[model samples]
Target: MTPGPAGTTVPAAPDAPALLRGSGLRVTDQRVAVLEVLRGAPHADADDVVRAVRERLGRVSVQAVYDVLAALGRARLVRRIEPAGSPARFELRVGDNHHHLVCRACGEVRDVDCAVGAAPCLVPGASGGPVDGFVVDEAEVIYWGTCAACAATPALLATAPDA
Candidate 1:
């Protein structure tokens, strides 16, 4: 089990091999390890993933982890979010039009449900029509601010320059 918010514990993720097969991808030890790592550490970067996977399965190449992440991303098994001034992070929370909350001070990230209304929440301007005839499928919103921990720490807040 993984530690969750507020000292809670999250159950282990579903079987990796089954998830891979269901997503029509070939199952491998590397893929399974990568999925397990993401399950335990959501919003992990490529480097973090590589480190964890290597610890689990000795001598995993960095390229191998990147390849696995790419395959998983293409299969829609994982979602990639790139917050400003931070490396791309991966999570298993796919299929939802959710947004993100990024802490500027410490670069911590958290999930936020879709902002008001349905999928493609924010419409184009006052007319509520597509801008320049561009059809919108999803709205990616990132709320940038200080998180609770950062807000509580004066030194951390002071060190982070305004973006």
Candidate 2:
């Protein structure tokens, strides 16, 4: 079954075939379910993904979700981001150097554009070492603050009066 407009689905067993072909990955139920979960959740941890997948497929194991997450991460079809004090969360938003704004209090996440104009955050300073034919890959930059909704709420404001 194809992803519904909102991205979640209770797909048929064979529906994974197209997703696998589109992503250049070998089609498998686990992978498709994992991808679908990530697509729907956008920033779900392994446990959360397992919950979503189980709701659709039933009786999937945690180890199985981890394995599928690793495989899909390797395929570059999904991105893994781990904010400090939070479990790693997966998203289908890949191939871009977009940064994340995380709410310190509630652990909410939102995407933001890069700070320093482009992909790599900073230019190597003269003191910066290790230029021995090594090309820098992707850079993950996380900005920590209160989310908009949290900031507006009275309870959050009471907790962090300075904010």
Q: Please report, in order, the local distance difference test score of every candidate based on alpha carbons.
A: 0.87, 0.74
Against the true structure, candidate 1 reaches a TM-score of 0.88
- lDDT value for model 1: 0.87
Clashes of 2: 0
What residue runs in model 2 are displaced by over 4 Å at the alpha carbon?
1-19, 22-24, 126-133, 157-163
lDDT for model 2, on a 0 to 1 scale? Answer: 0.74
Worst 10-residue lDDT window, candidate 1: 3-12
Q: Write the per-residue lDDT of candidate 1 for residues 73-102, one digit (tens) a residue.
A: 999999999988899999987766778888
Candidate 2 local Cα displacement, residue 91, angstroms: 0.5
Candidate 1's C-alpha runs over 4 A off are 1-13, 125-129
RMSD of 2: 5.9
* Model 2 Cα lDDT, one tens digit per residue, 89-120: 99877766767888876788776656776666
